[model samples]
Target: MDETAQEKKLSAHNASPTQASDHPADPVLSGGFRFDRMELAGAFGDLGTLLPIVIAMILINNLSPSSVFFAFGLLYLLSGFVYRLPIPVQPLKAVGAIAIAYPAVVTESVIGASGILFGAFLLVVSLTGLMDWMAKLFSQAVVRGIQLTLGLVFLKKGIELIIHKDLFMSGAQNRLAEYPVNLIIGITVFALVLLLLDNRRFPAALAALVVGIGSGLALGGFSTLTLAFGPTDVRLISPSMSDYWTALVMLIIPQIPLTIGNACVGTASTCTSLFAGNPLLAKAKAGMFALTMGIVNLPAGFFGAVPMCHGTGGLAAHYRFGARTGGAPIMIGAFFILIALVLGELGFSLLALIPRSVLGVLLVFAGLELCPLLRNLKTNEEYFVALLIAGIALAVPNMGWAFAIGIAVDFFIRKMNVRI
Candidate 1:
């Protein structure tokens, strides 16, 4: 996007003339909800990142959808009230992807174990001030590198969702539509989103969902729908050493860098830039975010909910789509709470109503939202490190390895006084 368009996308509300919100954080000033068309549209901004993973885990891992939904709702609520911005809550992408790809090794229990284990690590870093010390180790170039890698990853997944058409590796047995049909729906929604993306009167996300849901219903979304009220029975988690081992290798190591670098530090940076001058966003710090994510997951491990994070991509999605105040997360949170209460695990069937094509559109935009952040990189050396990190992560398809390489390279560059 050009500078003007990027500015519009980052503005508090696309239609509103102010960078500060209409309520300007409201009667409380530092924290409150502001309901409006923009906030409503922004509410579902990250569903692209959310629904697929949860549904797949529920189907593949046999975790309770009700508890997953409930956990998400509560987490979103916490993000809104505490952060006072439309920051987001999402499943750990690396962990979710690992479980989905290798269900045999990374079972539901393994995922739950990851939640507990990683949550504990986050607490240690956050509470004991280790996060501050660790934060110093990650240079801006490395952080941007991490964010760039994720943006590219989202873009890839978005494309796959479009082409595969069967809920990320669901295969021929579960493929929903033929290639042509999938293409048409995805293209139509994508075009519509681009055209109406900045329009306040008819918000882009809301419009895209309307088409998605309508298309899904037309394709027989109701035939499989059944009411199954939930927050289903919670089971006490008792993961074995093997489970913890798998969780650490496949989920924790691969994913923890993201929660710390992007979710915590990178998101704090995004908040400072996007919500500058807003008092409500003043406390949006890396340590606090680290703590909040641990809080999001500790209770989750007991019920086998997916591990959660405050991904910067989700925040970019909300802001790009017009979320301004706390209302956005609250709106999405309440919606999920209702889904858990009313539809329970069966809500997955209903969500299937919205086609993968539509969801792909969401993923594409959310990924693209991160592009602007990269423009902040100034020096050639910073750009080189960031690009190298992104290339290694995407090429290896392993963030854990990429992060280690990034740190070593950044340190070498600083020590050698190397000039790119």
Candidate 2:
């Protein structure tokens, strides 16, 4: 066989159970996992989602970086093993954003209780199969709309990060006043990423990280490397009655809708779209998605670790940068574990070395990857529904609301027998 024929054979053989057989499996399945430099780079492709929230929680909420890193690392490894794909574990953005924005109002106990309560809720939903029902409620139009909105959000954030001086040091500077040197560096990195995107032998994300590190070092971003071996003081925490109450009313209530819309429905749709030929891919049902979040956050909550979830954006980011197997998460997970162990207290200082521009470029491309999914909408009616949902999602900046709106619009259109 020629190289192309051989590649086709490998792909067909690796198709998930759903694609391979008429009947799909009940539980989530995985494709074969491979560990390589490409997978390693794919692991870090979603840093834009992980780092910002983590940094904020640590700085604003006084959360322990060691505990957060450890939880994230351990969970990522487990997710890869369980899903057998590049399923990403990411910080719960709604909770993280709320906590960061209102640190004075949101207490640590509240955060911990939120995670515990949310985890339990998800666990029950998954076990009872309620998540499967919920997943079915979202139409393809709604899912596509959510994906587009998320892609745009990431893209906008990426552009912001790229133009800024540095995430930590920059205050309010001119939008166009970035140092000429930094602009040059950003342009160079962006160009390199675009050029190497299709080059399997040289993963673009890996190349970007290498260039970013080199540039950061040369620019004195890491003038001193402080490696510490001090023991971390993370312990299991039990939430109080008040903490649970606070979490239920404040955090859990707002987060549930978002989680159901994005983490469950959005992620499952993305997986199926990407791996259509694999029957096992269909096993990435809403219940399984919920189970992963519940398993990760329940224990992590006790230790004040940042709660995590599987996100469509993170999945797209990983797959966009050449991550095709379970090995990608495992590789990245091990790196996080190493960071947690070696730099228990000094984690923030080390992360500070990464340049904002490089991360921006990565986010930009990851967002770009998601845009192609919009093409899946075949009808003008589908496009109209999708555009409506996308508009609502972007305008209100609430994915849950947008999801509901999209579904309602789609239903109404179908009911009216509207033809475009």
Residue pairs with backbone atoms closer than 3 Å in model 1 (clashes): none
Give stretches of model 1 more than 4 Å off. Answer: 1-16, 21-30, 165-179, 230-233
TM-score (all chains, Cα) for each model: 0.90, 0.87
Candidate 1 residue 204 C-alpha distance from true site, Å: 0.7
CA lDDT, candidate 2, residue 157: 82
lDDT of 1 by residue, 98-188 (tens): 8889998888789889999988888889999888777777787887787788788889888877765453222212235444666678888
Cα lDDT tens digits, model 2, 274-294, are 655554565577789899889
Worst 10 residues of 2 by lDDT: 1-10
Off by more than 4 A, model 2: 1-30, 167-182, 223-225
Per TM-score, the best of the predicted structures is 1
**How many clashing pairs per prediction, in order?**
0, 10
